[model samples]
Target: MEWTLPQWGQLMTLFMIAIAMGMDAFSLGIGVGMRGILLRQAILVSITIGFFHTVMPLAGMVIGRVLGLFVEKIAVMVGGGLLIFLGVNMLYHARKQGEAGVLRDLASFWGIFLFSVSVSLDSLSAGLTLGLFEADTLLTMLLFGWMGMLMAGAGLLLGRRVGAWIGGYGEAVGGMILIGLGLRFLL
Candidate 1:
């Protein structure tokens, strides 16, 4: 297939969307990394989160593709709402950190899985939106997965350096970023 200007635009759009979707994972990874994870553990956690980022969106696209025929309009709205809900939930958790249950260690299997799911929820919604628009599935998923992995790694490393200075505020900042992104999507 010949690459056209419109196709380039679509690719760029998908790349931006992938980065946006990965922001959640990156932000949350920062929050968790603040607790001081080792290098090996960081690698493991990032990989797991990246894997979920890919899987969740792929699953969403499959479901959304089927549903798109019936409720394309509704799917976009639902996607927006889901992003808002996830953002608000993260903010709530950040605000109530003391009252909230202790976060699980990312080094553990269950901990990694739970964290991965929490971060990847937004990707699912994004995939749904992409499907509603009938975007290229393979390219979208690949970008999402790749960006998620890189962003998570970067966040973890950054957090390790600055986490102590930020203290508990890391999560709050992360939550704010997510909330802003969600509102942007809605508007």
Candidate 2:
């Protein structure tokens, strides 16, 4: 089968967006890692973040599809708006770093789950925007899940070894990516 330029471009865009989405988990994982975590706990947290990244985006896509059905004409604008909002929110949160105190109980299932959900929340919004555009669901989910886990694991491992210098920058980069994507949609 032959591939077109637009298809390749879309694929690249999705891939970058997926990585950007995972940056949240990466940054937070770094904080947790700096605090010192067991290898088992890190694995558990990474896996949980991956699961939530997959599921949350899928759920958002479902909701976005429903919304698109009702407001097809304005769906793109709405998606753009949502992305911008999410991006701004991420940036806002990134400024308030050094909150690792809140994540002291990451050894438990609930702790892992809550942390995963918190990190993956932006994926949900991004998925909603992609859904309005009718993106490839399978690819999006896979990229999100894989990248979320991989980035998070990297962050946790790095955090354990390094200082707390790269704390919130990952999230800041992710926020910028989202904002750029949102502007792309708008224009």
Clashes of 2: 0
lDDT of 2 by residue, 32-112 (tens): 899899998888889888998899889888888888899999998998888888788878778887643446579777888
lDDT of each: 0.72, 0.87
Worst 10 residues of 2 by lDDT: 96-105
Q: What lDDT, from 0 to 1, does candidate 1 have? A: 0.72
**Which whole-number lDDT from 0 to 100 does residue 134 have in model 2?**
82
Q: Could you tell me every candidate's TM-score relative to the true structure?
A: 0.76, 0.95
lDDT string for model 1 (1-187, tens) is 8999978987986776677666656666666676788999888888887888788788888887898889867765665566566557656765675565445577678988888787787788778766766778889889999889888887787778774444335445545555565566578
Deviation (Å) of 62 in candidate 1: 0.8
